[model samples]
Target: MRFSSTVAFPLAANLLPPLASAIRISPAPNGALLLRDSYDYIVVGAGIGGLVVANRLTEDPSVSVLVIEAGDLDDRGEDVSIPGSVGFEDPRRYEVKLTMTEQEFLDNKTRTVSQGKAVGGGTIVNGLVWTRGSTANFDAWERLGNPGWGWSGLLPYFRKSETYSTRDHDISACKIPVPVHPVNGKHGDQGPVEVGYPNYYYNQSDNFLDGVQQLGIPVNEDPNSGNATGATVVPSSMTQKNQSRSDARTAYLDPALGRDNLHLVTNHTVTHILHNSSGNAIASRDTPIVNVTGVEFASNVTGTMMNVTCDKEVILAAGAILSPVLLQISGIGPAQHLKDLGVNVAVDLPGVGSNFQDHPTLQPVYKYTAPDVFSVQDIVGATRDAVREEYLANRTGPWTTPMVNAVAFPALSWVTDNFRELLDEAVNTTSNLPSSYDSTLRAGYAAQKNETLCFLSRTDTPTYELMSTSWGQLAVSAMQPFSRGTVLARSSSIFDNTQPIVDPRYCSNSIDCKLLLLGIKFNDHLIATSPMAALMPVPPPGFGTADARNETSLDETMRAMITTGFHFSGTTSMLPQNLGGVVDPSLRVYGTANLRVVDAGVIPLLPGAHTQATVYAIAEKAADIIKAGSSDAFPGAKS
Candidate 1:
């Protein structure tokens, strides 16, 4: 049955001792506090995943959940709550930047990879796009042996965690729609999470959608229905009337914050997962013992190390990059890599830090000769002051805008069936399969064979995969990318000067490069289309004839301008241990039982849309599995 409201489990009171004595809670030590000396569940990194898991698990009174957030909660006024304040260039919402160095990807020079280290994780400082991948994509995962990961299996959780706010008349007047799936009974009605259309929109947004439609792309009513193959104006995680942005903290934490069983510790960093010498049976054991529990954290202000312990499980929700690094530091990654840095290997799971993937985006901006829609600069000065006054007075203004007002999915023709056949043949012929080919590869090969032989009827066409085509002078990104990358820690020490290496290997695969280039070309084609061209009389800056020429080769230009889509996945990938996967289908690391990863890091492959909604779904499903004794909840026979 449905456990949405009837599940009235109380949190374990014995787990939380006071913040004063349980652990040291001091701001002088970077304003970090030890709210609980021991908890049944110690979730590391207060990102979307951690917050969801903690919030869900705490519903049970018997389970004491402690969420240690490295960064402080949003105290910078209501600027973060504003709707129009979203964009890559917006600096008011994001203050603390957790920087990483990626030398292998960007011109082989160290580049800073910044992520929000605060309460809501990237949700507080992200595009706030609410989209999901294609059902076909998830079906492919199940076909590859991950049984429960299929779209059908996961759709329930997606609906359960969502509370769609679609009744606002202003949104309808703006032409923004919330398309719901026919079989959406599983969705919550009065849930705390708010999902709705943003109130404000650029006039060009409508023109942009019409332009793409004229260029042969169909308009989709609901992009989140698992078939993201058309252009449409998708919704965001925001309030309907006020138009204020709703972050993960607002959706998951704020409603449940008053629960005494749920304890939140800010300014605390989790260094590693503590394990006992039970050796390797740790994962399967029902009662795993902790030798001596402790967490390694530093002051957000001064960057100093602090150690704290947990009475039970240490859950790692440190996103795709930091999660794997934390595992390696805890001696759970490649045995050879850990030995090189003088750290004792706890678990010899070679896949702990392998199978990394990310969506690399290239935006070819078009300069609008006409006074384009309101630009970020337009809202500054007196406009900014007025918006600030409005926000302070009523919590509404341009400051509440999400990064992108609209998003659409378009398919690229290059990475179609023919391309897959060629890649499959090449992979089969290559004797050296990088020693990383495990179940995922075998499953991919098997799926390829079936596709080639039967010519399966699938909605997601490689020739036209999912691309986030939208209005404005820009397109969000292509939903699914064939390119694969990796995230590696430079040293075992959590405090190592070296940054965690992230090589997106963007456009490294010819198919991915072609898809990106095609997407850019298609976007340009849409702008030139009759219906849209009439409205968008002028294009945004960076779109010109010289750049759009057929002979110009948009591939080169895309490679030069492409940036990380920020949808990082597959680092601590979920696959069979033998297949170079760190976590199993249940999301528990192969060699460790008491420890588990509940974040984007375990995503076997990138979803076809934005990761925020998918991440929330993953966390919701993970909580269910964890609550249902872990064995009978997920794919594969439970360990």
Candidate 2:
């Protein structure tokens, strides 16, 4: 049922257009051609979601699919492809170089929020850990008016998106209690995306796991299964040979290069969606849900404006920040905001850019002063050169293994004492949110708070995610944060180079601050355990651990230390319109006929796991939904 094979594309495309014009080609068959043309579907943003949807929809040779990517191919060289290049930061790879408005809680400091600008999106420059959330996470989607979006409904598509592989040798030989499923047939084997465990495991990785076991957390062999609790060795989207990154470019796009039915236009920024007149027909109470005719775009290099039409639909997969920005500029946002910005209202959909959620993380670096292990700094001069030579020769060395190899998911009760009472107090108070929110948004936040309490009560699901990365750092993140922020266009024009204002509202919610502190306490306990204590861990050699004896000190230290987990969602939520949602169960924008959002933005809630795994599954399911509704989609498609 998977369309991962490139062979299927040509066989199917033979029934319609010639091979040359099947996908994307410059210097048209004729002398000249206008960039503004029509296609059955025009997908904006070439992220994983957009790529997956385009690949599946293009299975129909009769139906043309065009993917317009704002960023160029990630030709960033070795820094992007190699594993050890993680700690290095490169600003050119990101599309949205945003800084949040000074936070009221985080010492009034503005934190930078970046998004991937490459053709493969964040996959090109993200930590490639692969894991899924608990069953309760997806079931919550069903509870929020999105029927058939629970774990059971989505697992099939999860398996459909990637080819899962395990290590050849017994991973148990490491003597670490970490359970690993070597070759489970339940996982995908023939999909384009490669999902596998690392071939090389660090010496300290086993020690880290042992430390977690000493802390009384169970060891899970596989977190990909529904109930994701306990410590486990995480799988990643990596190649089996070189153990290098396997991103959206390698997954869905490269295979279908010869597909003339699929067109990829790179280095073009999508400015705004073009809509047709609704005439006298009212879409709702006082708004018009006008049909999206096309999208206006401009070349990144030349800055030449262009227009492209769609016969069927315009899909927006422009991530959380940009997607909402696009909607706002196109007049499908808050009526008052649009009016203030001098844009004609398409729909007074109040929920276009509200409910922004992310995994706010705090990384506490510990100095590894133990013997028999080498940190990134230990391999200096000659040793570093030798290691680099070995890696370049075979692509299998210390550099081949990513710093993030293992993770632990701990329940709140396991991490903190009297967690229930602490949670109840947090839930009862309205200080978790700003008091001036609109009535609909406030109701949405209230519903989210209830759902979060329900999540906290589940022992099988963990509220906090803990990980040890780069040999000397402990990453403690509040996986299910109660804080909801906003993404707003800096100006009325979509052409404005100024990035959208992204406010994650990190630690703004009292519950979120409490959870983060609990996570920090949990990490401290882990390092202080017998096995880890013998390692003689210090605070990055110079800096000392926060003296969080009191609430004020803890709050102040956390404000200075907090950063993003890079998992942003819920800007364009999937709840019903009445609940301040932008998209419906089918991912279609509430009031638009031919516009749908198929990115992390539509995720109404943040799952306990990383956003990578769930996003691929969501995209796969979205493709199925679009295919079932299309007359010319593949055969034997589910409706």
Candidate 3:
């Protein structure tokens, strides 16, 4: 089946009535006009986190907020809104040119890393899966010295950010059968973001669910209810009526656009964070720590520079990559590395771009030969007229769904017989630490290893996630990998347009490799088992060529095929300063008084789920934290 690189469907233009009427946006002003313009708050990026903080902080009519986004407003265009479309390929819609450095473990190959350059950020180009990590995942954050960040503490914000809508039509309409639970989940119904299921379900969904159950994995009542183990059909961030993609723009930014206090500056890239300094502007260890004052930005189109000051605070929500890069170039990274780049070191924090983590994923395809079953191939491979008819007649069709409807999170025990031995090796082995790792990074990894080993027996603390799509693909990923990577600025110039050196160091740790191998072996077993085998499954056209019957054969395929999950985080981790943490528990930088990083960058560790939902919850909680003046105002806030 061949998919078009560009589909001509402007789904965002058809946002349901009330949501469209709420926005009041305008283009950014000229860079020359703002020499010393100031506001109550300055948000660096207009992604999900930045937008959420901007909207909430502007709630008080007196406080003025400015959001400077590198990309323009994507008005639900064809690439941004349509599912399974090549939105990530559109340079205007996403940062398609971003490439990571050659990973040493993945056969020294450079991986293409796609980040949303548009206003909505990654939410504009992702698969639209709305899922939260396991309870153990969040609890690990609090255990790592971040107070009030466990599952229970963040649940309210999760509920507050979403407006749940049940699927109105019957599942039988899509020729798929599964037990329905309309109210078993704990989701909000009054928030701005829409959460619901697609009108169409692939016929393979039931087979995938049954295959996992046959493996002794229990069915989860609700994947979002703190426990994400078992086979489940996860909901997505989309509207129920036409299944329009509900991104940060529709949920958080649009609703707050009418506020007179909020100002959005599109097509502006934040170059560096400005701090109070003197004498040749050379920052060193002896330099006294001062509060962040403002930021300098460059016009995306014309390259003109401008400075915008803030009276209260400067929030960095430029996501995992840019957020850390901003700090590094702004003289807030490792002292030695900064000096090499000719950047003044404002704070000699070694953890600015360290502790980088991401999910290493691979596709294990299985060709199911069932005449009665309908696959995504039948949709995308169909005549253009047929797809167009279904879409134009009713917005809910194969063209609207991203084909990733069902997902499974399986524990190590469910996959391998020697779970105990694997856990011991994973927890005890510290030699896997890369040569670049310093004493501080090693200590941080030690803490993470201990916490992960503590949850070895818990089924909910899954080490890997298996997401099934209608395209005969099993997307397997090691969720809570111990392997750490680093993202550093190659040059001092932020606009040198030089891609940062992103080395995920996939499979660097033996335990991570072992766990990923287990996940691949589990998929092989599931496909060869009863319910799935009934469909006469065969190896996907080109993949699984070598026999996947054993770990040895599968390990080779895993190494050659493993790719980035696009869930980059942990660069600017939120932990204690002594534990190699850049940001404190309050989401504040340790040295700066009024600077905070409220994006995926602050996630101390990678969770066992997709990053979209957790990013929203983090923003919601950040709003309340910023409003109350301190993290201690919250119930779970640590001293």
Maximum-lDDT candidate: 3
Of candidates 3 and 2, the better by lDDT? 3
Query: Distance from true position, residue 296, model 2, in Å?
Result: 0.6
Model 2 segments beyond 4 Å from truth?
1-36, 93-96, 170-177, 182-186, 278-288, 300-302, 431-436, 540-546, 630-639
Off by over 4 Å in 3: 1-36, 84-92, 169-172, 175-177, 180-185, 278-288, 380-383, 540-546, 549-553, 635-639
Clashing pairs in 3: 12-76
Which structure is stronger by TM-score: 1 or 3?
A: 3
Give the runs in model 1 whose Cα sits over 4 Å from its true position.
Answer: 1-36, 88-111, 170-173, 177-186, 278-294, 298-307, 371-376, 386-400, 413-457, 460-472, 535-543, 550-553, 634-639
Models sorted by lDDT, best on top: 3, 2, 1
Ranking by TM-score: 3, 2, 1
TM-score of each: 0.82, 0.90, 0.91
What local distance difference test score does each model get? 0.61, 0.75, 0.76
**lDDT accuracy of residue 82 in candidate 1:** 52
For 1-639, candidate 1 gives per-residue lDDT tens digits of: 000011111222321213221222345454445456667787888788898888888878778887777676764234345545454333433434434344233344333355776778888767667777678766765665566888877887787677776645543444343243423443445554577766445655666666666665676776666667666666678776666667777777776755767777776566666666444332222343334365666643356666666666677898888898888777777767777766776666666666666666665555444544455546656886786666556544445556564555655432243545644543444222234445544454334335322222344532233332222346435455555555667776665623676666665445455556666656667667775565454444344445667434545455556666777887787765544566666677666656778888887766667788888878877888777766446632110
Top candidate, metric TM-score: 3
Task: Output the lDDT of residue 601, model 1.
Answer: 88
lDDT per residue (tens digit) for residues 542-632 in model 3: 3453566555656766787788887999999987766788887778887777889999999988888889899988888888888889646
Clashing pairs in 2: 22-259, 22-260, 22-261, 23-259, 23-260, 179-221
Task: Compose the digit string of candidate 2's lDDT tens values, residues 1-639.
Answer: 000111100011211212223355453565233353799999999999999999888878888888988777665355566665554435555445677878876778887766778878988877788878888998988887787788878877788887887776653233333768633534777777888766556676777888999888888887888878888888888877666678887688877778778888876788889997443222342242588999988765356567889998999999988899898888888777777778777777777778989988877778778776676555457886776666667665566666687789998887767987987877775545544356777777777778888889887788888887645688888888888788878777776735677788887777788788777767677778877776778863213445645656766777677877889899889887767888877788866777889999999888998887888888888887887773123222232
